[model samples]
Target: MTPPNTGRRSEASRRAVLTAALDLLQEVEYAKISIEGLASRAGVGKQTIYRWWPSKGAVIFDAFLMLSEGAEGGPVQLPDTGDLAADLTEVLRATVTELNEPRYEQPMRALATEIAHDPELAAIYAERLDGPLREAKRQRLRRAQRAGQLAEDLDLDVAVDLIWGPLFQRWLHRSGPLTTEYADRLVATALDGLRPRR
Candidate 1:
């Protein structure tokens, strides 16, 4: 399914559909959600949804993205108060909170599952969500490098993964708690290698 042309889309209807999707997701498991349910909840025709979104996963993903963007209306950004360790700690702690939030956990897991199996949807996820975020993380790392806080020759891409990969793995596998303390440890341990040599 082709991505919707924003030029022709109605903002009001789009918001309704996204809101309905989130509401419906809260009411039932992801596997149980249907386009019909979304249409009815949103008070729009099924064709309206089909016109804009390629699949159920796409709609749900957009809903989560919208929620993340928030009422302030901006792309989410990682904290960059010039303290690399503190900024990473703050971001990771928030990640733990979001991953553990009951409202978000199921829908996020559902999206993750869809991205894993559907190459097209996965591409969209990476393009719309993951890419910007990784860039922001790298931007922060670059700042640290320039300030002589981080290894000058460090690979930002791998550094981003080193900090985030474990937390995600733990959450995805249910291998351990995603507590603030765990987030702190992840940042500290990753920074041990990232910090500039003595």
Candidate 2:
């Protein structure tokens, strides 16, 4: 029923739409962005965008995902040097740098703002972005726990929340500079309680 060229055109249009959506997000806050603008910037008909995504929020999320490569640009696996403090400190420091990068900041903020007002977008984002990141962190923490580097009684998920929550709060709220020093402090405070002690 569909021509072979149809699939190629659809893919091309989708990419253009996503690229335009990301560009617009950088220039305008999420609340102010519109489908008409996205279509014009993308050079596609409004119908093309609506066919692929239900909302601008969905387009923005997909764009972020594509840019980050699904958050795989960072360390693929947690550093397990058998030293919990060092490993966590290194990871958090890298995370701070990643969050502070201008390329990631605006779009991330846009997505966060969109999620707050839209439950459906929040659910999709959780499944695509949040869930993967949480799972990776949990797996890393579990490794530390099994190595006796972390306390046997420590809850990995809660521990991850404790360590990462402050960083997220700072980035999302613009509360403070997300520096290596700040990340180190977070890791230190969280590890002080988590690390196995004599």
Candidate 3:
């Protein structure tokens, strides 16, 4: 059986460890990070970090997850202006800006690289981070459906992917510029395909 948790102090240590992981990731390549480094930077014992996280990849993934959830330190929620296209565009444009920001971009790239190589870490990321974010996207899409902006028959999962996939791909591959104009076009194109037919 697992031991009982240490409540607030443990939570504080976890936050410190995560913050240290992000700071180290930004300063050095992912491959260079180690448990010793993280523990030292966080001012926690190596055992403490190991007790909570299984590996350096998990630590880095969690750090990225926290920042992605909210760069300004608040919960991230999609806007429900009752305008589906506009809402998506606004979110995507904000994503573009965040992706361009050095603080978010570098750590994100590290986490992405780690996820690609570590299947277990990837599964954790999908469950903890991607799942909630996708659900939120679906919720916004559902609102659009209710508002008569999207077709009732549309698959919310596929719709979420269809809308977010391009921006992600572009960012991952550096395929093209992620400008607001591009975001607008993506929303317009996706909405055109998703809207109810006459």
Candidate 4:
């Protein structure tokens, strides 16, 4: 059936599709979800879904983005403080929390596992989920450097890698506990390393 053109019902149908997609994504692996399945679950026609979203991946990713959005429908973002260490600590601590939350953790793992083999899915994940957060951190670091909190000549790409690498490694390998304390420690170590030698 074609989705109703009325504004209220259209919004409702969109929410249903989004909610159903997220529900299925959390329950099943990424590769197992189909647009037909989502439409059935959402109680909308496949044509309606196609009209709104380009593909199953787009719908699933949109659902994931919605599920992970911060307050006011924004992505999880880094905060800028004059103190670089404090800002990093705040951001990484929140990251630890999200990584520890099962609702997000499981879905993230499912996406990561599949995207490794599918470049299209990987690109979507990179652009939608990871890109904004990385850019925010880069902007924050640049601001800090200008404020004299970091070495003027620091390489931002390496600095970002240093800041986020270990955390992602641990998250990927499950080699150690991901805790706020660890996040704080990571920030302190990076800050110490970034300081110019006296």
For model 3, the run of ten residues with the poorest summed lDDT: 68-77
Candidate 2 vs. true structure, TM-score:
0.89
How many clashing residue pairs appear in each of the predictions shown? 0, 0, 0, 0
Which candidate ranks first by lDDT, i.e. highest?
1
For model 4, residues 54-132, the per-residue Cα lDDT tens digits are 7666676676767766643655556764666777888889879988987787666666665666688789777866787
After TM-score superposition, what is the CA distance of residue 81 in candidate 1 from its true location, in Å? 3.6
Per-candidate TM-scores read 0.84, 0.89, 0.81, 0.78
Give the C-alpha miss distance for residue 149 in model 3, angstroms: 1.9
What would the per-residue lDDT of candidate 1 be over residues 91-187, giving only the tens digit for each residue?
Answer: 8998899899988887788788888888999999889888888888888888889999998889989998899999989999999977999999888
Off by over 4 Å in 3: 1-12, 68-76, 194-198
State which candidate has the highest TM-score.
2
- Whole-model lDDT per candidate: 0.86, 0.84, 0.85, 0.80
Q: State, as a TM-score between 0 and 1, how close model 3 is to the true structure.
A: 0.81
